[model samples]
Target: MSTIQQNIELAIERWRSESVSQHTLSDSSAYFRLAESLPLTDLDAATTLAEIFQHELTFIPTSRNSGDWFIWNGIIHAKDEKNLVDDYLATEFANALKKTADYATKYLADSTMSDEDKAAGRKGMADLYKYARSIRSAGGLNSLKTRIRYEFQQAPDFFDHDQRWAVMSDGRVIDLENVDEEPLAPCPERPVSRHLGVSQSGQWPAPASLPTRWAQALSDWTPDKEVQDYLRIAAGAALLGHGDAKNIVTLVGLSHTGKSTYINVLREVFGTYAGELPPTAIVQKYGGATNFEQHKARGKRFLYLSEPQKQRTDDAFLKALSGGGDTITTSKKGQDGVEWQAQCVLHIAANHIPEFDTSDDAIVGRMNIVGFDHVFSPESMQRNKNLVQELIEHEGSGIMFWILDGAREYLKLGHIPVPTSIRKRSQENVVESSAALMWLKEMVDSGELVIDPDAYMKDMITPKDGYAMFSRWCFDNGEQLPTQKKWLKDIEAFNHMPAERKGKRSDGHARVWGVRQSAHRESRKLHLVQDGGSTDFRDLLTQLETVPTVQ
Candidate 1:
């Protein structure tokens, strides 16, 4: 009968006919306006609007903060830092509450209201304040925070495409029209973010020009098709979040050689799923607070470090990133630390090989090195100046297909295929980075050192300890000798067996490793001896065998 009652009924009638599910609460501003007109005693009307808020949003309280609010669109999404959804809801709620409080005061002075109405108004105002306090303190939007609490979920096997979900490498896109379907059903946890920029059409025969152009860009890096194929699969692994590949890809090349261009394209397409490598990720800092640097990569699928100059790579951090099994602990400034298994594949590009603190197999085995040998001529550079943007704009869909195809291939193979170029370069990076490896490799190449495998069975200790020999070699070459412990580890990593240490200091058996001077070098020395005729290596061995030991 009253205008306020008529307006509230009209709003409800429109809600039933149009379906409140069809639009978010923010889109239906008329309902909030009706709440603004309702009498203060109309607790039922306020309750209805509050119930709509519960259906539209879910709040998750964090340990030390008010927490995050997620709203449902096609899929539930967290309130983005840049978005105003939460702000809009807060403003509307405040306005409606303010209007009702004003009504509670205005009705007190009104001559039109019956005596029963004034007494009910006073009670309603007290009840409204109590309700508002409950909402402001512990209850949020009809207790939505408690009733509908949910954790943000991740679907590693699926990536967000446009506004829908598509199975990675499968090309089957989920129809979000009915989200209550098996995988998309509204549950206690749900994926609330989109990472991929392009969607798979599931159609065959991608645009030929895309691959052709991509091949051209890659050809500038390497002429080897296997290397190109490996790079393609690496991209696929990145897109599919397959850190299980357990290898970090290093793109080594000169400027204008297309390495950064390639990385930039991936970063652009990966969007939120790709993270920039923080300084602490590669270089370890001393005496600093708990570095939250790794936290930036929490949900990322790919991380890129570009042109890091003259810094020793953090072996432990990098190993943990690609190792797949290690759980990394990261924290915010005041919040509690969170632990997660890193699923991100790292790609580091630099003009030269990156130095490392150590050169063990853990370092060698986890690296995938790709060299971009060609520096594009000024003319070629001029032509492909905007190569990355061009490829992304014109061939985005095809590129997505290419990457997904690589994911499918990687899944089928169960591992990334190492190309000859990649293997060679990766080994070179490890060897060149360690002084012990360099000295050992040089000695081997010059016929000055050889592995004595027979000594392993005989438990023979060389007259000279291998580490001592390496120390002397380092002094001769003006290189610093690594610690003895590291020397052993490096040699073992170089494919030589662990050194055989026999008996205590009381016994004559010295702690010697399994390396000795090769007969080639010894014979060469014999050739230079004037008093002694050039003795063959076989004769020298016999003479040494006949010699008496100090023991």
Candidate 2:
């Protein structure tokens, strides 16, 4: 028989002898395995591989467009012996092709073969090697990978690590091995890409009975029992990637307050799911280097920033990342951007509260500022220099369990209870950062400013005119004037909306703010007159009455 015909017979006989009693040919994988065992020509083996095995392996294209291929091992798209699935396939193909080529070459040396038979076998061997050479050429593996992407009916989900998934919606851990088995059956619509580094062991210890180092650290970091409990709850919330709280947690204190130590421990415990909080998330846009830093937050559950500069926070970015349910888009240079709901919760360790536009109530509502006031003494600080590592090394699982407990409690509560101290700190820091609001408070407190709805008919302060007045007040008081936009935002936030009027300005139309200083403030009146508003502004102030300040 010709080499091809002879090899086909040998393959069938080998399968019949070794596997027919055990498995039917209808089993595609078993049949493929039988074919692999035969000394078939390279071309035939490669074709057989394509026909039976292509569907078993999947191709996953990553964000970087690297040729990352995975194999569908009936359960998950997994790697082959820690190598990309393509690598394993190429090695297997090369080895099998070499064995078959050697077999075909040996057959050509048969002295008993007739001249015509040898000539036909030589032609068949040449054709097999020619096709096999094409398979081994450049781009061959890539072409195979491309076919997998386009030919497969179902595209394999990327980023699933086959261990832990992103925070479970119900806060329960599901065994991925048994994902389709039980009460948690009905697989997730999309695989969760992020996982906790450590799994929760069993029942968590009571708060008072936590690991000694952890309890002591918590107590030292936040002396208030409520705040201490809130810290645990926050950790739990972070563990589950729960952003529903819509709040950014800041641990504020001076050095030696154990804040850094606690955050360090938390970072170690969080493992692969935690990343350094991106500077873009904390700093003002256009003020820092951004190499698509936000993209690093992808698949992370907790993001921690240490001692960010005391600049105005990126309010919108912070809100979105902190769980406002806003979509965050990240792009690499020369690449299309990817958009997803940000699942990571941010924790900041700050020596002081970062500034934010005080007018944003959403920003205000989202602030969960916890104080780390209890300073560790010099001796204690020295002793605990290595405490964070020790805690993680020995009490890592216990800490994870504690965080898990907090997560369960957070789910049950439906909200994290804002400790009294957190509320107080948040309010104090917001007020301190807003000079516009502070100026307003000073004016109202000093009986120099009043909110009069009737002022529109008399001393109508157009929002621009209001800004001019505010500018003069800031100049006179040696306080820097905030941007006009922010000043207006603050004014509106203080419940002062703009009212429309015709024939109210030189332009004959205006949107006047709902606030004004008392007409009796002679200095403000003179300043307004001197500010070149003397023509219309002087007359407007004349119509003002000494109205009592509205609380």
Model 1, poorest ten-residue lDDT window?
151-160
- Which residue runs of candidate 1 sit more than 4 Å off their true CA positions? 1-63, 66-79, 82-189, 201-210, 312-314, 332-335, 358-361, 381-383, 451-456, 459-464, 496-517, 520-551
Model 2: lDDT to the true structure: 0.59
List TM-scores for all candidates, in order. 0.69, 0.67
Off by over 4 Å in 2: 1-85, 100-130, 139-142, 145-157, 160-194, 200-209, 278-290, 310-316, 332-336, 356-365, 381-383, 448-469, 479-485, 494-551
Query: Alpha-carbon error at 307 in model 2, in Å?
Result: 2.2
lDDT of 2 by residue, 86-167 (tens): 4444444544454555545564554456666656555645644654565566665555434434443233234523323433
Q: How high is the CA lDDT of each candidate model?
A: 0.58, 0.59
RMSD of each candidate relative to the true structure: 9.2, 9.2
Q: Which residue pairs collide, candidate 2?
A: none
Best by TM-score: 1
RMSD of 2: 9.2
- Model 1 C-alpha lDDT per residue in residues 363-382, reported as the tens digit of each score: 55677888888777878852
Quick one: how many clashes does candidate 2 have? Answer: 0
